[model samples]
Target: MKEVKKMAQKCFPLNDVDYLAEDLRLFHAGRTVGVMQVTGNDFHTVAGAGMQTIVGKGVAYLLTQIDGLGGVVYANTDNVVFNHDVADALFNRYDAIIIRYDKETNACALKLIKGTPSSEPTKYIPKRSETEYELVIKYVYIVAGVGTITNSDIKDAILNEELCGIAVDTLAKIPTKQYDDQMKSWISNSQADFKKWFDDIKNQLTEDAAGNLQNQINSLNNKVNDLKDIFVVMEEDSYIPPEERKIGRLYFNTTDRVESGFNNEIRVSPNMGLKKV
Candidate 1:
């Protein structure tokens, strides 16, 4: 009998790179970001409602993991790495961090003319150079600005009111109400359970990290407080007074004189959506 030889075959299931890309797309889809459109008899506004949620959650997750990272400066083109280390830190330190996506350009060949300057606008393609990207994080101030609401004030508002009327109305169209309720309940119960269970476990362990965990919890609580302050400012700017039927827009004067410790250069346009509502 002749010996038989078998040919080697390449096993090509999904590789790690492809797997990561798929996961990233899925994660992006899950957030309240990306493009949105509204159409119906009511002239529904389909603005990206999840934009805030996605940014908030993403920043929160990143913040917990970032230790000593500084403002990230990365390339804008092909090998773009969207690191959220600074975002995370800002999320923990400030009420809101505004992130804007900007377009980039490539360098062009220069031509010189005698006497008269070149009349043509610089040539710019939709393309960016290999390493051209910009990411900025603008921190939202609580209490010390146009509105007097402090971080503590926002938390007070939450506890005082039956519910945050503005947040509820904003999330009215969300299909994840059931999930949200479930998560809220779980968080409430888990916090209590962990306090007891973890205390017992910590006592038994040779080295207890309870102090460190508490510090982290405190830091997270501070972030929540900061957000509360921002909420009050937002409410003041946009929330319609009960006596007034029309929802008011939030207006900020960017060019106005700056108060100490506050930025005056970046003004907020009163939300046009309020009038439409």
Candidate 2:
């Protein structure tokens, strides 16, 4: 008896439009591996053929533009028994999937696809064969879309309560406008207050400096007056005569004192007393 070997499955490349459609389908289904951009009219012609053509016999393609979220390319495969499971899974996962045609280029791409999880998981059964059970497998395709998603789109989605699973009424609950105005007013007032405080400190410093300089000048004037007092001279009446002064002696002549002999008498006397003039 001879032993047999199982054959390996082969992979093939999809057309540009089909690839674009597959990318859209995965994006809408939230199973995307990455994103791509489709340019030119060729994208439109095939997308116009509808989901039947987009999905093709065993696989389908879709494309869309996204901004800000970043770009990637991705795909997946799972073995299953029923075909309806794939459709059910896709429908359950996605909230909405939009397909639009660009008239200018006569091309169509997946514009947007939003997704949510299904309430229940898909059930599968094993196939029985003569020798054992066999598991069937299915392939899911994904590709890139045309254009890019922008930050503005994300902002709009957040504001509109379209993204993040937030309710529209919840966003309306906050007073955004009032809060913004209050914040601006508070900032302006704070800046004004800081300026006033800084000016006050500066003025005080200037005044103190002037006061210190004046004090130094007054102290200097008082020192000068004290110095003058130390060097002051006494009144003239208080001065001692030079002849009577002990420091230096003086001599005086008396010629008319002798009464008897006026013509021949003359005397020299020493005057030791200080005299006042």
Candidate 3:
């Protein structure tokens, strides 16, 4: 006798097949959610199925994985794991993940998820979130009579609080005495070189050499002026006492001279203001 053949069970019933297909298409198209606005530490939207849960848990996960240079993180629906080596590959592989930021925004945005590339619906777009981008602070000190000071030369000046235009918080972040000796040695050498250049200019020995010396002097002078422009002393009216100040605050102190007691006392002032709370 022939045995009866068994039919395999279908994943979905005939009526539900269309709905499942549509949902699958939506997932494949990456139409999971709209633009996610990250304002500070909070996620704006708590609606949608997977999105709501991801927003609540994944945001914190994204923040932790952010590197100093900044980048996007990816995860499966169930697990949010950020591995730098695999972020790009996983980002492309996953369908329902959010993107943190891109190079255009200076890696500032909180939610940079891939979607259908449509304008976010008015109802879904949250109020603009205030996000803070990580900044790389650099200190450039300009000396008037002396040539441009090296980063090493400015270390002591920075630590002593002699450099005015720099924010106090920025100053606090610097490694104290990291460049003190190096900067001092550089200043000594630079002064000696300046004297030699000055003598060459005054002697008027060879036109070409003198011209070159003069050009060097001119370049130095321009750098000094540029430094002056950058380090504008905070006006007395805007001064916030140190005790009450926050990070990224820009204030000027008239008393703090750039190269104090030097023949060319270039007064360093704070400018561009600070980014504080």
lDDT of 1 by residue, 132-181 (tens): 22112222222222223222321111111121111122234476779999
Candidate number achieving the greatest TM-score relative to the actual structure: 2
Each prediction's RMSD over C-alphas, in Å, is 39.0, 26.5, 34.6
Ranking by lDDT: 3, 2, 1
Global CA lDDT computed for model 1: 0.29
**Candidate 1 residue pairs in backbone clash:** 32-50, 76-132, 76-133, 250-270
Model 1 poorest ten-residue lDDT run? 60-69
- What tens digits encode model 2's per-residue C-alpha lDDT throughout 66-121? 32111122221221111111234233332222223332354533333333334542
lDDT of 2: 0.32
For candidate 3, the lDDT comes to 0.34
Better of 1 and 3 by TM-score: 3
Which stretches of candidate 1 lie above 4 Å from their native place?
1-17, 20-23, 33-96, 99-277
* Model 3, runs deviating above 4 Å: 1-204, 238-277
TM-score of 3: 0.16
User: Model 2, poorest ten-residue lDDT window?
Assistant: 155-164
Top candidate by lDDT: 3
User: Runs in model 2 with CA error above 4 Å?
Assistant: 1-167, 170-172, 209-277
